[model samples]
Target chain A: SQQGEEDPQALSIQEGENATMNCSYKTSINNLQWYRQNSGRGLVHLILIRSNEREKHSGRLRVTLDTSKKSSSLLITASRAADTASYFCATVWNNDMRFGAGTRLTVKP
Target chain B: GAGVSQSPSNKVTEKGKDVELRCDPISGHTALYWYRQRLGQGLEFLIYFQGNSAPDKSGLPSDRFSAERTGESVSTLTIQRTQQEDSAVYLCASSLTSGSFSYEQYFGPGTRLTVT
Candidate 1:
């Protein structure tokens, strides 16, 4: 079974606009990581936020995690057409990890 | 250096036939994972192999599915008596270690399997 569930099954935005996606999980997690998939294939690791940390940033990506709420959000700033892809949240517990359904984002140039 | 690799970028098989998907994880990595994603759906965890410990097969949907890995090198996922509902993209990933949940996984270009 999937642990996390991403909201806003789809989103559309213009270039340079910021895009935000939220994910909610069911149980406790050791860490939460976000990934981006292009053409529904390989997934590229984006940012990882541990349960101890609340927020993290990598380049243009910002991630925030709230263990109490069992939720996390990924914010991409100054989005570009290249940023258009399916974003997923994976919650890891112990040695196991489960991914969400993913939010399909489209950045119009 | 090369990343995780999976063979047969795409495969179409007839129902009731058997198909095998292969994965070659990055060298020195001690953790391997397999997942299945149906069209327009979330990825479903299949199984994982962490170093020498026994593989975790709890996520496998049925007994028709099985996976094997030798040490930390290569892995294969085999599905017997394939069904149409089994069509999905199979993804493989590897991490430096599964002992830590903080390690990011490196993914391979998934193999798309279509059972007709």
Candidate 2:
């Protein structure tokens, strides 16, 4: 069963713009992690925010977690053409990790 | 030094046939996971293994699906009597450890399986 559900199933934006994706889960999670997948193959880990942490940043990627609402968001600043891919949010509960359906982002160069 | 690796990048099998997919996790990583992703769909967890503990197979869809791991090394997912609905990309991942909420999972390139 999938634990997280992402909003805005698809988004298109021009290069240099920013893209925001949101995810909501049903149960309490130990942490939330975001991943990026290109060509529908391997997924690359982007960032992980623990439940205790409100926000985290890595490079141009910013992740915000709200445990009270059981939601999280990922913001990609200055999006590049290469950033066109599928982004997924996974909720981790103990040893089990469930991923959302994902939001497909297209950045036109 | 090498990340997780999966074999037979692509496989095409006829319906009702059995297929096997392999995964070699990163060295020294004690946690491994398997997931299936349908066309344009999110990943569905299949199984998980941690160190010497029993594998958590709760996510497996049916009895036709099974997997085995040798200690903390290579793992294989076997699907018996495959159906067209079984067609999907099988992904494998490994982490430093599980039962803890800190480590990030490293994924493999994934094996694309097609059931004809």
Candidate 3:
């Protein structure tokens, strides 16, 4: 069973715009981490937010977590063509990590 | 500093045949994990190894699927009597340590396994 499900399976945006992807999970989690994967490559760690944290920022990325809602959102500010890839949200619970289906983002320059 | 590395970027084997995949984690990382991703699907946890302690094999799909780690370094995943349904991209990841917080995982390029 999948613990996390991401919204908007795919999104297309223009360069310089902000792209937002949301994820929701079924159970409580210790933390949530976001990862990006380019075509035919390994996944790159983006950011991690603990259950106690409501928001976090790293470079152009902003992540928000709502424990009560069992949801999280990742925002990429000033998106670029280089940001075109698949983004995934994974949850850590009881020493186990599970990934969501992911959102495919395309940035048009 | 070398990142996690996996051998045989792609593999193809006939049904009922066996296959082996390998992973070499970062020099000093202590935690390693295996995951499987099917076409257009999310990653599924397969197994985890933390140091010399017993590995967490709860996520393995079947008895035919087994993994071994040597001295907290190289690890190999073996699939016996493979089936077509076992085809997928197998990914290996390693982290400095294991816990729910503060540890970041580095991933390998992954092995695309095709069981015909």
Q: Where does candidate 2 stray beyond 4 Å?
A: none
Candidate 2 residue-wise lDDT at A53: 96
lDDT tens digits, residue span B75-109, model 3: 99999999999999999999885555866789999
Can you write out model 2's per-residue Cα lDDT over B8-52, one digit (the tens) per residue?
A: 899999999999999999999998999999999889999999889
For each candidate, the alpha-carbon lDDT, in order, equals 0.93, 0.94, 0.91
Each candidate structure's TM-score, on Cα atoms with residue i matched to residue i, is 0.97, 0.97, 0.94
Q: What residue pairs are clashing in model 2?
A: none
Every model's DockQ: 0.80, 0.80, 0.65
For A1-109, candidate 3 gives per-residue lDDT tens digits of: 4678898899999999999999999999999999998884689999999999999999999999999999999999999999999999988886667788899999999
The lDDT ranking, best first, is 2, 1, 3
RMSD of 2: 1.0
Q: Model 2: which docking level applies?
A: medium
* lDDT score, candidate 2: 0.94
